[model samples]
Target: MSATGHDYAITRTLDAPVEKVWAAWTDTESYGRWASAEEVVLDVRPGGAWSSVMVIPGGARIPLTGSYTEVVPNERLVMGMNVPGRDEPVLMALDLTPDGDRTKITLSQTFDRAEDRDQSEQGSNMLLDGLTRFLAAA
Candidate 1:
């Protein structure tokens, strides 16, 4: 939870080393391998921009764009992302912790409206689950 009234968090564990998990996030090519099936164009530096088009199960493509707010090598990442046509962009933070052979990943997203926050919470959790599976296979 954030100081802002509209925020949500999701924590997940990956049965992989922290460095390997981090690479799945920081490496643009690796990120694309799991972030979406279509393609992911990521410039993963502070202030760098990133975008992805996810080919959903029904074959619909949903595009998302964001700018990196912070990029801490293997520890964390924060970004401000917006879905086109949406009113407010969300602030998303990904925190990683190493625990022996496993890694704990926490994802937090804050929105401006309560409704949006709720929706994002559910959606992000699904995405995180997908990420977890992706990393495990990598």
Candidate 2:
């Protein structure tokens, strides 16, 4: 937790293979299918860029942008993202573990400030829930 006061970690299991899950995260089209509420665009290689706009249930939209910091096929991904009005970027790490016929995905995000961390934890958990649902349907 940086100056602002928040810290969080979220994990979810998907009934899909690591490869399929990786594809959903790295491919723009598949990412949009699960991760995007309004829109999503991704350039998945290291140093590549990504962006998305999430529409809240009540009609507000929040935009997010980031660059890929690391990518390891179907195992891991690390990215740096910045929220609107925030001066510092947050670091996010995604770990995918193969579990027999399923995949366990863990997402960890660290913010420079505690306030942002708390806010992001809630939002990211919601997004992960959506991803779980989407993967189930897919």
Provide TM-scores for the models.
0.86, 0.86
Q: Highest lDDT: give the candidate number.
A: 2
Global lDDT scores for all candidate models: 0.80, 0.82
Model 2 scores what on Cα lDDT? 0.82
Count clashing pairs, candidate 1: 0
Q: Residue 7 in model 2: shift from native, Å? A: 3.1
lDDT of 2 by residue, 1-138 (tens): 545445577888889999988888888777776765557878888989889887787888888798999999999999888756768667789899999889999988766667767887887887787778878888
- Model 1 over residues 7-101: C-alpha lDDT tens digits? 77788788998899888877777776666645687788998988888776578888878889899977899988877777755678999999899
Could you tell me how far off, in angstroms, the CA of residue 102 lies in candidate 2 after the best superposition? 0.7
CA shift at 24, candidate 1, in angstroms?
0.8
